[model samples]
Target chain A: MKKFLGAELFFESLYDLGIRTIFGLPGGYVLKIYDVMPSYSKKINHVLTRHEQAATHMADGFSRASGLPGIILCTSGPAATNTITGITTAYSDSVPVLVFTGQVPTPFLGSDAFQEADHIGITRSCTKHNTLVRKTVDLPKAIAEALFISNTGKKGPVLVDMPKDVLISESEYKMPKEVKIKSYSPKVPLKNSEYESFRKVLTASKRPLLIFGKGACSDFNKKLISKFLNKSKLPAMSSIMSLGLIDGTNKFNFGVVGEGGSAVSEDLINKADLIVSVGCDLIKIVPESNLKSKDIVVVNIDKANFNARTKGNMNIHTDSDNFIEKLSAEKGLSFEWEADNLQKLREKYLNSQEKEAKTNKRAGIFKLISNLSPKNSVFCSDFSYEDVILQKFLSVSDFKDSILSGGNGTPGYGFPAAIGATFARPKSKVISISSGINFQFNMQELIVTLEQKIDLTIVVLNEKKNKQKKYSGPDYKSLGESFGVKSHQLSYNDKNFENNFKKFFNHKGTALIEILI
Target chain B: MRHIISILVDNEPGVLARIAGLFTARGFNIESLCVAETEKPSLSRLTLVTSGDEWIIDQIVKRFENMINVIKVEDLSGEDSLERELIIARISTNQKTRSEVLRVADIFRANVVDVGPKSYALELTGNKEKLEAFIEILRPLGLKEISRTGLISLKREKKKITER
Candidate 1:
């Protein structure tokens, strides 16, 4: 008889799914599961966050960096409620994540027992799928189903609420051979005809521009995009999510292009006759583009269904990579419009950007680090204007990674996500940048960095008093020292600040850089 | 303009709260709402009456369609549809007004369900306008308490069942 405790089987399932790290907080109802986690610690790392919400943010950052569903575990009541912001952020941005919450005993449900909260009810609207486990026998199956729903199709968050008694209960366990949700079947390897038509329209246009979004950030899409750009020789720009999925320094690359995008990108959008949309500008942002409905070609995963905003526009529903792969397969396309302005525009934008960065050193902290850094890696920031400054100054790279919370507009996400991003790629340098005020939201998570002792740099931007509000806060440098992490502070007036920045970078382990503006 | 939107959703717990809470949380007004199980055992149809401009109504319908467990949302206010509401009122009755009330009820084809010594319980099923008119005529008879099953509607055009 293959019998195991339900809680033990839960780890077996997650480990089998290739989940390396589980960001979580311990609680009474979750103690049964935590008891077994130490046995598997060598195989899986548990990053105990100061707050459950930060745990989810770390998972979100990990998912964005690795293109895998990040797992977050929490206890009942407040533990579960705290995760709502992260879950909604994932849902809004289409990042895949799995959330497991411990619930009060099954019998006590609806009776308002100790630490009881309706996890499924509260998160139903925000999540793509969720379930409350009743029978212990259903635990493994429910876990499998939650992962399946979150990882497939238009990816989003899925939650599973596990009762404490159910974790204690036993059943003959069999690892599910396969998991399936009957209603969801994401279209794959789109029909060749759809690709053929899209290719013809794209090839014929003299003034064509390609724009990619988060949907094109998957590993497979990265390969397809490089090949597509190489063959077609078309200039391109990234929508906020697609940053770092394309080479920012590439001559054809325009910076991110919407709402918070640059003037050059906007001008390119206005001048182009044909705008190719690879899963972006669909519902909300189209109002700003002002592009005629006829000029847009939306390529998505709908299997021939029209996009929300581009109802009458030409939309080819297919896997973005598969479609682009086939389009690029045909002997590579290059247009001759008598000294095409595409390459010229790229150089024009690059020159102006350099001039701007040189003039704006106040904005130059982000610019200098991005441009002069020896190694390229992941970047994470919050929903503040500081993010607008970062995106504007930083150059994106396809080989690197960047994680933005994507309009969740919540402040606490950047730093924790950077920690998780570093864990995703431990050897590489991960920069978690944020303004001073926003950085305090979850600065407590810095302890995890100390426990793990990884190479992570957290840069906090602080503004000095100009006879305005005083900088009445704790010394962040001293704060890092208290956590047993190296810290440095730099402001404009410091004559040796530049030299200290170099030494800080040379220092190993976890480091914090506070730059006063 | 007023709009009546019909939504079909999975008959599950907490789904009603999600829908009603969305309206209340967003401060969208709901004039009336009627919900019941549809012909299918697993599904429930909710009819909600609201008033707003074209843009507000569009946003509400689109957002409702995006909710989990919501299978379909149809705006029946714009199309040619049949609308009905049931209103039950307890009116103070006396010797002078009893026959008069019955005559008024007869004109509207309303039914007198119960007759207490001093009050008569009247039930009327019609469009909102007809019910409002009847309420006005019954005011002199001393209308007391009323319960209304808000507007529910369906398009007159013949159609096959939509896939869930």
Candidate 2:
């Protein structure tokens, strides 16, 4: 007898790759894969979601929290297409995710077959890589490649479009112990010349600034960055995406820099002689216009980011952690204190008082995070005003933690991502920062979070309406209405909102806190 | 500003498309790219020359490393490494031109992979420099067509490195 069945082989491969859970919806097209899922239930738990979008979001969450590739499975057509938004979110944010979609049978393909869509083409732009499995025998390698693509350098989502016939085809399966792709290889180390160039720039600079992004918070670079930041006494400002990377309260911390960022933070970033940006894109720094001055030097991990600035700027391409480590070891660097100017700048922008106000949420959800978060806590948030506010609050604390958010400004991302984050960091407390609108967008995520027994605390900011609209005009109310959130729903009429939220979390292992504003 | 990254990957269809899509979608610049199978079977090496800042490169590398079939990725631009060769064939057969091409090849330690009646297939091995020099000499000698084997390199002996 052949040692492995196709579906069995697929699940085993996923297990070997350390994937413990799959988030998705099941249908006829994926019945075979779903049937074998039970056999691996002990090792892998499957989270059944109401919509395919939620599944992908969960995978996104898991990937962000764990620094491991999150997995999602869904049926064909609308289901597969539904994952596009989530996949795009992962792509833009650089999240590692493996998405498996069931396709119509090969015989039925391109015939307007029931629940059929060209997933390969639709997702081509959003995913880093995607494949359409034609044979059952190819399943193992295809799955492996998807996992690999999703987890590798500049990590992003990879989709595997498995036709129903391929899933059901009987064939002997041989899983490759290793997969080798000729066209792809992740650059691991910095070139010596690049390293030397960075050293020369660092050594020659009087005032240096370090800007860390979400990617710096990964398990691979966290400690390395921490060591470099402390040893160099380099004042650092984190991108909003990288809020909790360093302890926000640390002396060297300057907070997040952007449109809504602290005034001091922006000044520091602008005035730095040498700006060492670790995994952060210039989107935040160069809002309406470019901030590249002749004195600025940017060292980044991805070469694609080198001259992203349209203006004339000095940029070096190297892995952020790699460069930081090299710079820390370099000897003979000294700078004369430009104290008076530095003090003037600091006095002009730094607001220790605003920092306290930002952290005032500490008395509410912010405090809960500090008090309840485990050593390995993973924080995931949706695209909401509250999420940004929470991020600003967390910016001032020193919680060596990971934060996951929608890079594309997509709403309803928090809950599913939180669920995924829980799976990614099972030992840590996973928290979701959401608003009433986001909560409504994917309320089903709460069910999946509970079913998976994922230890999660969802802090839902209960407001009667879209707070962002108050400043924008009449269009805000119309937008809220379009989202099915009525004016009445925006207001907190239920006096026991917290108790209701607590009840939702009770006995489910997951908790929900509805804060009335 | 463009740095060439040589990656050893499984010679599977769609791999190139996937890699290209990644660059294009991210709006990263791919100044030049060359992909072909190597001496190894079922494996091809891709030399992608792209330009980006440190953040973009990190993002690219991180994305590449996560792919399943990609065996290894090396940024040859930053390391002290051995140069890989690219073979190009062009129509040029005059004795003087042939000798001139061979002289340039000999200087760069290149080889004649093929010798047709009207075309000489020259193989040059070196970093972009030697290859460009070889091409420049051939250019005056009826360099009708050109193909490059992007870049393949092995790290000079020193320290063993591990991927983060």
Candidate topping DockQ:
2
- Once fitted onto the true fold, the runs of candidate 1 whose alpha carbons sit more than 4 angstroms away are A1-6, A106-126, A171-206, A282-339, A371-376, A465-472, A490-500, B80-82, B103-111, B126-142, B155-157
lDDT of 2 by residue, A1-517 (tens): 5756566777877888788888888887988988888778898888888888888888887766556788888889888988888889988888888888888888887898888898887887777778888888888888887787677666788888888888766787667889765555555577787666667777787788777776566554656666665555667777877776766545566667665655676677556766667777765555624354634555665555655444545666656666666766755555543556645544544465255454554224554444445455566667655455455654323223545454687888877777776676677666676766676677755556545566676666654344554422223233333433221212133566434534443333565565555
Q: After superposition, how far is residue A127 of candidate 2 from its true place, in Å?
A: 0.9
Regions more than 4 Å wrong, model 2: A288-290, A308-312, A337-377, A395-402, A465-508, B1-164
After TM-score superposition, the amount by which residue A191's alpha carbon in candidate 2 deviates from its true location, in angstroms, is: 1.2
Query: In the order shown, what is each candidate's alpha-carbon RMSD?
Result: 4.0, 9.0
